[model samples]
Target chain A: MTDVNSVRPQARAETSVRPEEVLLPPVDVIEDAAGITLFADLPGVSRDRLGVHIEGDSLTIEGRILLPAPEGLEPIHTEVGLAVYRRVFTLSKELDPDRVAAEFNQGVLKLRIPKVEHAQPRRIAVQVA
Target chain B: MFYRSLFPRDVLAELDRLQRGMQQQGDVSPSIRGTGRGGYPAMNVGSTAQSVEIHAFAPGLDPASLDVQLDKGVLTIAGERPGVLPPKEAPATVHIDERFSGRFRRVVTLPDDVDPNAVSARYTDGVLHVSVQRRAAAQPRRINVV
Candidate 1:
């Protein structure tokens, strides 16, 4: 119980979110034997407004969504006022960050990271005597 | 080691899911101002001097699959977001699944001054934008006095 309680706060602060109102976009992570894939939903964000960066073992994704209100338009109804999305993750040492690949479409970003050769599983052949 | 086994990453993920569910339930209170609680594809409506613009932030949807309708003074946006999860038999393990999927629909009641026939809708970068022109008489105009 002590171990769980000690780790709970760290897990909640996994993304290192700031105090300001920053929209944390929902994300999905899938891991296989080969590598891991991450998917983030970023609606209203264009390709030019998105930034993905990797330094050391830290991975960051940032995007800005600016809703265009034509001149003389007054907002009569508003639900979502969020304009920025930011998330960060500490990659595992077994993953190869240099080979990361990313793709964006329909406001969704997909990132793929492959495992290092030494970390990948290999089937060894046994000699029959 | 036993305590470590007791609280694996999956347990934390389950707790996160539960927290999100609770928060969403809290947002479902019905309001006359039309703010949806925990609704998919959140929307915003604004009016200009000549037109009313409605924007729905919905990603991961095909433009052709979206259905928009304007009847009387109500505008409806309906669409389906396909699930991106792996199959049960796949060897992959999903650590997180937070994106909203499946079918969703949002309805907005426009003002009486809008012209139903002059409405136009378009989908770009996963956002559905609908613009409805207001009636010419409803727009404010200046008159010169002698």
Candidate 2:
């Protein structure tokens, strides 16, 4: 549907630089009649370390892992290095950023963005003439 | 009645899909650089003179649902992450679905000097940390010069 295409955001753009690698956390975006809900998996990131920003039509989610090896420990085998998680998405014009709601649990971030009142679905009453 | 070909296009397509799914599930390769191709819950294993620490990055899981077991010098971490997608019938369009779901298990072989009886596991902030203490005899000691 045309509406679906209009509501779906484009792929994220990476524009940050750091010594360590920046990882793109896996995300799931679901859109219903009311709005769109985004779920991102960011493990080892505490509440204070996580940051969500909305500027213009762009939405950014950034966080850094806070779990570090204890003192006197040397890495014998490592598969996941200490890295940063960052992703940006372009929101649709129909979505209302001011009313967005977010929740974090078990290292997962959930963001709900509702559509503007005029963009939402409405039923029209029919009358006999 | 019309006869259909032996190798249908849809059947071949389905087989291809199955093969791709299997390959994605088993994409993990052992490396120290964290190549970023390892399957769900990337892990880091480190060791100290007293204990060996392992951290698994797995989010959106109930702490009670995790299973950590060490036996015969092998440590196993297993858990399932419930899917967060909406129902199929719902009038919802999924733009991107990249998060991992379903049952996942990772096994690590511990050194012989580790004391399995002294292992402890804790899950916090969606990260699972497991520590196994090493035997006293295996620890390094400082020698005095006379």
Candidate 3:
């Protein structure tokens, strides 16, 4: 397991100007022979409010949460305040950026990034004498 | 290697003590006021004139799997989120595993004025919203001067 603290420095550097709180959504990244897949937990973010963009080696994910206050209700007790979620990852060149597939359901976002043809492993056959 | 496992428990206990000390200093976040426990799935509690609303910020949990219960005045939320990787296959090399997946339960005591019979809950996107109506006597009434 990659230490959660290790990934924060890079993401924090990317969003230095924002005065509002920028949450680092918890994520799971799995890498296999084919490629890598990333799953991010972004509760309260709807489909239209989510944004995923790749610029060169940097991959940034942003989600806006809209929480409407119920009518005629004065908030007596408040805890979890609303804030936008943002995170950035530095991607390697071996991953094919154009072929990425993404899906959002419930409150999780899944992104699949395939490896380039040359980056995929190939088995060789043995020749008989 | 054996010592590493034992070391964390001591470290964690120390950290907990330090956090408690910090909380006593009045620097803790107000939202976590009643719910003293920390880590995974933070929550918010709010109240209107007629109802009390609790918003649990838990994502990636199946809606049907969540268990919500109200006993006396305390509300309990329990659920589990299965790990993303397939179990049968060889473990894929993980780059990061910050997302926690396991059984979790959070219980918070509510005020005595809430009406248990008039509770409603809904799960949308990834938030579990639980609203319980308050008893008539608990609501604030405007006084008129003749």
Candidate 4:
């Protein structure tokens, strides 16, 4: 089993001065023979408001969720407040960062990271005596 | 089990603290206790003179598959989300799986004055907006001053 801690990236200091609170979006990371796939739930985030960046060994995802209040309505109860989503993950050498692909739809972001050629599993041939 | 047994009171207190923290963060719905998972799809409920509006933050769900029903002043939203992994490919191993999938249903009771017959819903981006008009008698009206 791969040690997740070894490859996990550390969060950098907050530099932006945005007033909105940043939230940690829930994510799922799946690793197969080919590579890893990451899915993040970012509700109310549109394509223009989503950002995915990779620098050095860190992968950062940032998104803003905007839910405008309707006119002439009074908020009686609020459970989900508007906020920004921000999270970062570390990348391992076994995977190729250049091959990463991302897709955003219906408030969800899916990222595909392909493994290096040698990192994939292979079948071995038997030798007869 | 052994740790809990050894520090029963401490564990209970810690659990209570954590619950309180989660509640203060508004991450978990009070109705769904013990689920412990933070809000998956946060929601907001508001009211106006003529109608009540409910907004549920759920994305990536098939619009056609989304189920919204109102019965006896209770509104229920249910749907299924397929696994994020590609269907055709077989995964050799899974490292970190945190995303919640499968089917889920959330039911909330509406105000007694809501008009069940007058209801409309729309799904945009990932938010689900529901509007239900209030009963005619329940609507506020101006009174004439003699």
Candidate 5:
């Protein structure tokens, strides 16, 4: 069996997130023949504040969500929810860095990475010639 | 994410009282506030031939109040959701926290190939939609079609 102890530290860091905090934005993963698509909700987020980087087999997304502070007067009994999301992904061999792309709209983040062409199934054509 | 509607009867009643209370306290009060996440906003992301599309769920936030910017491959949205209730003389009471207000900001990084200049954003049905087109050279073309 694979050794779980070897990767225990990495897994702990993710769950060690603060108690009052929530998980990074909820991410939806959809797979097709091409590759995987990732989407996350990030209300009040914008292009200037978003960041994405990939290293080896790991991809990381970094973002800051500045809670909207109420206007006028001191924030008495404050409950402004402030948040920042940091998520990582372990890519499969099908991933191709050269074809990776990302976009942000409103508060949603999207990523598209085309799979290695050879990894996809071929519509095998019979040779009539 | 679900932010309760300020228009709901219960929320409306509380808002009315909050407005009155604010007036008494001499504070320019906000019309609404959500105690928690207000559930969550719905989001969808997809791509087209020339661009990628991202839609966020924020009902009270309109396009006019929304600000978008792109830099260093990152997309950011920042804006204020002004009090939606009509100006009132009474102080405001926030019994139900459904409306999200204040200087909210959300940031996202685009792919390296994005042509920031080609990015466009729109709002409809309280949903903000953004389209970021890719540079022709960045997208691989079909070499052969069977």
Candidate 6:
């Protein structure tokens, strides 16, 4: 069995090299009747490189999007303003592990996390006594 | 062990040794792509009640070289952005770079209910925005109070 506690720190350290990749956009979390929706920005990433991992209370999202190298003339001077985007979030206890889903399109990452069935409000039928 | 009934002797023998050598290498890369941004031009996306807007942040793609297509609910942005200067000899320790250049492709999958025919695309402010409208059945419709 893998010890996530040990592995997680190493993964976290790897992220330090490309700190800018940690540029997670402002997340809009909406909890409606259906589920919780989280909107995250992921630029330059491809469908394949996008990663979503779940471990108990931890949810990790990371991808390394490579920017195209400059063309025509050789790079005499270069400043890479934006390289890649990466971020991770801790999942709340209410999250229904079985119902977590995500999709990435047009630089936006969508996470649909349904609340645990018990945590969700339920309607109780009343009987006239 | 169950599969041994199918494979030849040599192949099955290799499988046993292979299993002994294999080790957990840990996670290699992100399942989501663009994790390694790569050679394509950057693009932006915006979503609203009416449409999901996508913009390619490219300044060098020529109008004539651009080709946009929406096929089977997939939006593909393709264009050839010509490189500037084409690299030239410079004095000692000289290196030059301009941001935009080369061919790029960005393919995005739209929701099942997107109306491909009603889409609108334009290149303005050096950004190519493709607007895809939601299909009538999926769009919000006002109920008549009468």
The per-prediction CA RMSD against the true structure, in angstroms, equals 7.2, 8.6, 6.9, 7.3, 22.6, 25.0
Q: Candidate 5 on B1-146: residue-level lDDT in tens? A: 38856486988889899976765564354424322223233344455556766655564555776788889887777777554322345333222233444677665556678888898787753457677888999777979877
Q: How many residue pairs clash in model 2?
A: 0
Q: What tens-digit string does per-residue lDDT give for candidate 2 at B1-146?
A: 26877888999999999987786565466335333446778888899999999999999899899999999988988989999887898889999999999999888888899998999888877899999999999999998999
DockQ for each numbered candidate: 0.59, 0.60, 0.51, 0.49, 0.02, 0.01
Query: Which residue ranges in model 3 land beyond 4 Å of their true spot?
Result: A1-19, A71-79, A124-129, B1-20, B27-37, B86-91
Tens digits of per-residue lDDT, candidate 1, B1-146, equal 54666677998999999987776675556456444745888888999999999989898899999999999999999989998889999989999999898999988889999999998887776778899999999999999898
After the best TM-score superposition of candidate 4, give how far the Cα of residue B76 lies from its true spot, in angstroms: 1.1
CA-lDDT, candidates in order: 0.87, 0.87, 0.83, 0.81, 0.63, 0.60
The docking quality of candidate 6, as DockQ, is 0.01
The structural similarity of chain B in model 3 to the true chain B, as TM-score, is 0.76
Q: Residue-wise lDDT of candidate 2 within A1-129, one digit each (tens)? A: 677645435522233334456888889999998999999999989999999999999999999888756788888666667568989999999999999999999899999999999999988899999
Could you tell which candidate, 2 or 4, scores higher by TM-score? 2
Top-TM-score candidate index? 3
Query: Per-model i-RMS in Å?
Result: 1.4, 1.4, 2.3, 2.3, 18.1, 19.8
Residue B126 lDDT in candidate 5: 47
* lDDT, model 4, position B117: 95
Candidate 6 chain A: minimum summed lDDT over ten consecutive residues — where?
A70-79
In candidate 1, which residue pairs clash? none
lDDT of 3: 0.83
Tell me the tens digit of each residue's lDDT in model 4 across B1-146: 54546656888899999988876576435554443234545678898889989888888888899899999999888888787654545655566666768887777778899999999988876888899999999988899999
lDDT of 3 by residue, A12-68 (tens): 788787676787888999998899999999888899999999999999999987654
Q: Which tens-of-lDDT digit does each residue in A1-129 have in candidate 6?
A: 678767779778877784343544334555655457666555555677678888888877776554332122222111224545556677778778788888776455678888887887677889999
Q: DockQ: which is higher, 5 or 6? A: 5
- The residue pairs found clashing in candidate 3 are A79-B31
For each candidate in turn, the TM-score is 0.79, 0.78, 0.80, 0.75, 0.41, 0.39
Ranked candidates, highest DockQ first: 2, 1, 3, 4, 5, 6
Q: Rate residue B44 of model 5 by lDDT.
A: 48
